[model samples]
Each structure stands twice: as C-alpha cells, then as structure tokens.
Target: MPDGPNTLLDLNQRSREVFRQLVETYLATGDPVGSRTLSKAGSRTGGVTLSPASIRNVMADLEELGLLSSPHTSAGRMPTEAGLRLFVDALLQVGDLTDDERAGIESQLSGSNRTADGPLAQVSQTLSGLSHCAGLVVAPKRQARLKQLEFVPVSPGQTLAVIVFEDGSVENRIIDTPRDMPASSLTMASNYLNARLKGRNFDEAQRRVQQEIDARRAELDELTTRVVEAGLAVWSGTDAVSGSAGRSLIVRGRANLLEDVQAQEDLERVRRLFNDLETKEELLQLLTLAEEAEGVRIFIGSETKLFSLSGSSVIVSPYTNAENQIVGVLGVVGPTRLNYARVIPIVDYTARLVTQLVR
Candidate 1:
C-alpha cells in the first residue's frame, strides 16, 4: 500500500488482485471471505498462488488500512463501507444488461399497454422487480398548460374555479368572492382569461394576463378584474391546479429488503430503512443531489446521512424530458452489498427510457 492521495492506485499487484477477489466474493454471497477461502478461490483464478497463512497476513494489512473488517462472530473478512466505495469507484468492472433483462425492462414499460398507474409508476415497478430492491422515482411536479377557465357560482360568496389543461386534466379550486359580486362577472372574467392564458404555463399565463390588464385590453369593471386576478393567483400559488401539490415519491418492492436478513442486527437495520423510506423528506433531498450530476450516482453505506444508520446504499440517476430538462430522479435503494456491476446499467437504461416516454 502507498501513502498520500494515491492510496488506491499504490496497492501492489498482488494486494490488488487479492483485494479484488475478496470484495467480489463478498458481494456475490453477502458473506465474509476467510483467508482459506480466498487462497483456494484465487488459486483457481490463477491470480493468487499464496498459501492461507500468507493470505491471512494480507487480509490483516487490508483491515488495518480501513479497507476490510472482521465481524465479531467470524474470523472471515468483509469489505468495509470505505472498501466498497474504493471497489465501486476504481476496481469494479460494470456489466451490461443481458438481452433477456433488456426485454424484461422494456416489456414492463410497454407503450399503450401500460397500466393506469402512469409511466413513472411503471418504471418504479419495473426497476424494483429487476433489482429486487426498493425502487424510487420523484415525479416531476405537474404543470399543464392552461386550455380554458370557468367560474361556476356555488353561492353568493363562493365560486368554483374550474381549470382545464391542454392535456385534458381538470382541476377545481373554490375561491371566495365578494358577497355582492354579480353572477355575470363569472362569465366576464372567464372570457377575458381564456382569450390570453390558453396554451401557456402558469408563469407565462400569469405574465400575459398581467400585460393585458396593464394595457387595458381586459375591459372589465374593478370587481371583475379582481375576480380574474384571483383566479390566476389560485393556479399560480401551487401545484394544486394540477392536483399533485405534494412531492410524488413512488417506492415499490419494499418487501425485498426482508429477503436478505441474516441476523437480528440485519433485521433491525432493515426495519430502520423501512422507517427512513416512510419519511421521504430526506430521500427526496438525497435524490435532489443527483440532479446536479450527469449520470448514475452511487451512495454507499454511511455516505448518505439518511441511510447511515441502516448501512444501506442508493444508486440514483436523473431523468429528463424531451426538452432535455431534468424533471425527476429515479433509482434503487438496497443493502450496501448490492450488485453494482449489474444494477448500474439497469438504472442508467431505465432513466433513458423514462426520458423518452415521458415526453
């Protein structure tokens, strides 16, 4: 091993080979790799001809360097979180999705035949099924362009602001009006807004409506003008107009976390993870970090604060729309022992496919 910033690169060829074998074995079985096991396994791979005693010495050295650890119950060695980071960042050779895997992913996202749950939900389900872990997708906030507006009078001082979007989604918000407002003012405001706000997003529609009012093109009495302004304010204030005000975090395959519990400690960790997933504010913040990066981001155990206690890992990627604007994030969460080589490409491809279909 070498000192300074180049520690990972400075490992001797023998140490590197042995370390790689150990990490690979641990990832595959989620079990500690003993010196005897590494010696036999490495000899078969034609990489390490060292005896068990020599292998044990090397394992001790790696453990001292904070790359591996020994569980209290076994003399066998397992990679630490730092070791997994080093492996993922520098040592692991990522694998591509097999043809069958690709077909499976595509079949789940099949166009026109997808379920009523929508594409984002379908993608989450597909990823969860393929990865055998909890899949997460932060759906983009709905911002449909306005098609028409209506103000149906419910009572003397209440009116239902009906908003129709170009995509055919309709939203209704009840707004208070002056008790003495004339019934004819509803139609007046509706006509004035529909004339200029159609086919525009909230911000653009608001700007155009204001411009018309400033230019005096909105010919209405003071009360009718105020009513129109209030109607616009309702949609502009929040995503309530699109009926998705709260953050949309789709998590599927939560039960998969239960599949690999080896002990009481493992069970506790899984339970903590389940609790963490329920309080998604942290997960949403974690996923937001991926939006700034370009491709798949791997967060090993303790790297992300939210999953630190559980010692879990997350692999997230941002998905964009047809305009190439990042609209949401999608990924999987699993134990630190997740199969990165196989999961990385699966996540990347799923994100790309989602981008294409989302538009």
Candidate 2:
C-alpha cells in the first residue's frame, strides 16, 4: 500500500490514473465499480495493468480518505460528492457543442416571440431538450428605454396598456379599471406619463411616474389618478396578476428528471427533488448565488441547501446585459451522477449566446 494521498496533487501517477478511471466508470453507469471491474476496464482507460487485488487496495485507501463510498456489502466503490467536486475542478474534460446542438439553440432563441412571456421560456425549453435535464431560468422582467405608453379600453372594466420600448419590443399588459371608467380619462393618463417617461428606462419610469402622480393628485380627477397608478403599477411589479418581483421562474423538462429516477433505484431521493422544484423562491435564490462567479458554477448535491434533500446537482451560469450586469441565470438540475464533462460546456455556451440576446 502507498502512503496516504491527502490531496489530488499528492496522488502519484498510478493512484491518479486509477482514481480517474474509477470515477469515470461510476459517472457512466451510476453504479459502484468493483476492483475486478476496474482491473478489466483499466486497459481501455490508460492501460493500467494492476491486478484485482492491487485495485482493491487502492479503492480501500480511497474509501478511507472519504473520496469513495460503499453502499452495499459488495466490494465496489462510488465517488462521493467531495470526490466529484475534485474531479470536476481538476479532471473533467468539458466538450464543445455539436453543430446540431448549436443550430438548435439558435433556432429556439431567434424564433421566440417577444410577448409578455419573454424569451427566457424558450431558453429553458431548448436547454431541457438538449441536456435531458430539468432546465431552470431566473428571468427578471425584460427592460428597455421607454418609447411610448398607450391605453385602450378593452371592455367595461379591463383596459389594454400597450407599451413600446426603444429596443423595438412591445408589451401588452391588462389593467383593471373602474367599471364605468371613460376612455378620455385613460387617454389623459397615458399622455401625462408619456410626457414624463419619454426617454426613461423601465425602473426609472416606475419611480418617476408614481412620484408625479402622487405630487399632482389634486390637479387630476380621482378616476385619472387611479389610471395613473395602475399604469405605473405594471412596471413597479404591483400588479397582482404578476405576483412576482417583475421576475419569472421557469423549470422545464421535469419529465427528464423523472427519467433519471426510473434509471436509478432510489425513488425517495427523487421524490424530494420534485418537492424542491416546486419551491421556486428558494431555487431562484440558489441560482442567483451562482452570479457571484464569472463562469459556470456547479452545486452538487448537499452543496445547495435548497435541494439537499433531493441529492441533485445544478449546473448554472449567469447572462448579462450590455452593461455587463447579470440580468438572468440559466441552468439545468439533475441527479448527482450527471454527465458533468458534457453538460458543463453546454451551459457555458448557452449562457454566452443568451447574453447577446440580452444586450
């Protein structure tokens, strides 16, 4: 037996090769790899010629170091979450997207209609289909400089608030109004806002418009004042219909997660995963934390408190606007044994592409 290798750097060539081969096998099959299986597989990985007895000794050492675990009485070992982190940080061989995948992502993002739903939904769909994992996205409301704001009565108590942005995007929001509200009052409210929010961005318009309405309330009739508040309310995230901070949470491809559960023997862990996805606020908060880093971030199993019960992993990246501010986050969630080497680059490439659309 060799001296204990505390860190990856401490591992000699033979130990490193054996460790890599074992981890790769575990990731591929999501099963423990016995010493005999590894001995037979060694030739394929790097011509490792150790006997089964020699391989067993190495696995025992790895187990003692907390890098591998034995789930059964069988003489097999599987990499633990800490081992996976080490592999991802040092040995994972990230691959580039295929031509077909690149084409697929481009088609999805470019073909999406910029409706109230925005393009983020399309992104999640594309990622889910391509990655075969549950795709998650944290989308702040679409932003653009104010071009114009108009109000048209749709019915007795509902009006259409048509907003045009400098980026050539149009958004239509429905506002509830007094049952007998007149069209002239809606027009007066729209004109007043257009005068003040001509070149302001969404957030700025939200603040200034509300302040103006409150300051000049005496000059306007009660009906007109109500319209003004409702108009700015749409931007300030006060609309109950939205019920979010002008931000949307989308999780696509949950069916993909179910497929993983079917492949693995553990049903209880995956059931917990479904419950975690339903907790969108906590999941969104987890994704937001990934923005602190520059590139793709991996939160494996217990590393993310929100999904710790699920024994799941998240591969996420943040998308930024022209000012390089992180405006959205996109990623996938799956079992801890996900094909990290393949999925990491997919996330990295998708995030870059989304950044262009955001700009």
Tell me the tens digit of each residue's lDDT in model 2 across 207-247.
77667666874357889889888887776566665535566
lDDT of 1 by residue, 1-359 (tens): 32222356767777788889999999999999998998888778886789999989988888878788899979899998888888888899998888898888877887534433477888888888889999999887667788999999899899999999898878888987998999888889999888877888777878887888899977899899988888987766533432233346889999998998989999999999999898776677788899898999999978988999999999999999888999899999999999899889999999988888888
In model 2, how large is the Cα lDDT of residue 53?
Answer: 92
RMSD of each: 4.8, 4.9
Overall local distance difference test of candidate 1: 0.85
Worst 10-residue stretch by lDDT in candidate 2? Answer: 1-10
TM-score of each: 0.79, 0.77
Clashing residue pairs in candidate 2 (N, C-alpha, C atoms within 3 angstroms): none
